[model samples]
Target: MRATSQDTAGGVRRTRNAAQTREALLQVASRRFARDGYASTTVREIADEAGVNVALISRYFASKEGLFEACLAAAVTDLRRDAGDTSLEAIAPSIARRMVGATSDGGRLPDTLLLLLRSSGDEHVDNVRREFLQSLSERMAAASPAGPETLLRAQILLATTLGMALLRTSMSIQPLAAATEQDLLGPVSDLVDALLAEKR
Candidate 1:
């Protein structure tokens, strides 16, 4: 038989419904994983927040580990271009300021990474950390030399960004929280310039 108009409309509706469901689940999962941390945030909670069944999450993402991996992938993809475009010196301070700013109201991406770091516990955050850092290093080392100092600068920059993110987002420290945009950029940029010099 031939395809009918109703059949085509029904297919379109199903596709839209699935997309909406996935998007809703991802939004809930991302926020909860960011706010509550990944290990503490359960599929049931995410499901409830999304107003869907627990099985729906599994159907969309397979497992909690899979979901975390997806978030990591997203974080990596989003930052890859930013990391690739600028010098380490510029990138470092930019990262510090952006991270601080991103966390002013509690950022989901940074929080998710922090949560993953914490949840790793005694198992070693090395592999995951390395994956994130390696991509960063490669991106920043584009026009520069690659060596211990360069790696160190990259690592420190990453650490600074993450540390600032934690301080602003997680701990909610006053001086940092109250810091002016320039207050953050001034010191961070100087440090990055120095670090980049060392890498040279």
Candidate 2:
């Protein structure tokens, strides 16, 4: 049978409400997971902050684990879109700037990285972290597909980028943190260039 007008209206309302709740939960959960970590943050806390029912956590995200994963996925998607290609030049100057709070939502980069780092002890988080690393490695490898040592090169390149992110934000290293975006971009771009340039 075709749906009635009331049925269609109700369905639309439900869809809109679900979308709003999911967005609210993500906005709160992202900050909480980043600040308090996965194990420490409760579903109730996320729900309360989002001004929704605690049950919404289960209804919308299934569980705290699911919500955590969703947060990671959303953040990664945003970064990939914002950063453009994973190219060394594309990453450091453009992406790196966004990571270091050079823009409004740019701070999410460090937040997500730190969240993953802090949550690494958990088995699920470990798997997710591995997947995240592997994806980046693949992209990096593809960028220099001619090399026999693509995997190693990718690992080194990522390590450099991750270290710079930590020092500039998480570790709160002043020289790097205080440096102007242009100055920081130069060194990072050069480092990435050298890494990409080497075959051995």
- Predicted model with the maximum lDDT: 2
TM-score of each: 0.71, 0.72
Candidate 1 per-residue lDDT over residues 1-200, each given as its tens digit:
21212223234322226666776776677666656776788888887887656776787788876665555555555555445357655664656555544432234445644544544232333366567677665556553454556766766766776777677667788897667667777777776666655443
lDDT of 2 by residue, 1-200 (tens): 22222223234422236677788898788877776677788898888888766877897788887888888777666655665576644656764576556324434566755555556255775687778777876787776634677777777877776676667665678887677667777787776666665544
Among residues 3 or more apart in sequence or in different chains, the pairs in candidate 1 whose N, CA or C atoms overlap within 3 Å are: none
- Off by more than 4 A, model 1: 1-16, 100-109, 112-129, 141-148, 178-180, 198-200
Cα lDDT listed for each candidate: 0.60, 0.68
**Model 2 per-residue lDDT at 105:** 42
lDDT at 86 for candidate 2? 69
Error of 1 at 38 (Å): 2.6
Query: What value does the lDDT take at residue 92 in candidate 1?
Result: 48
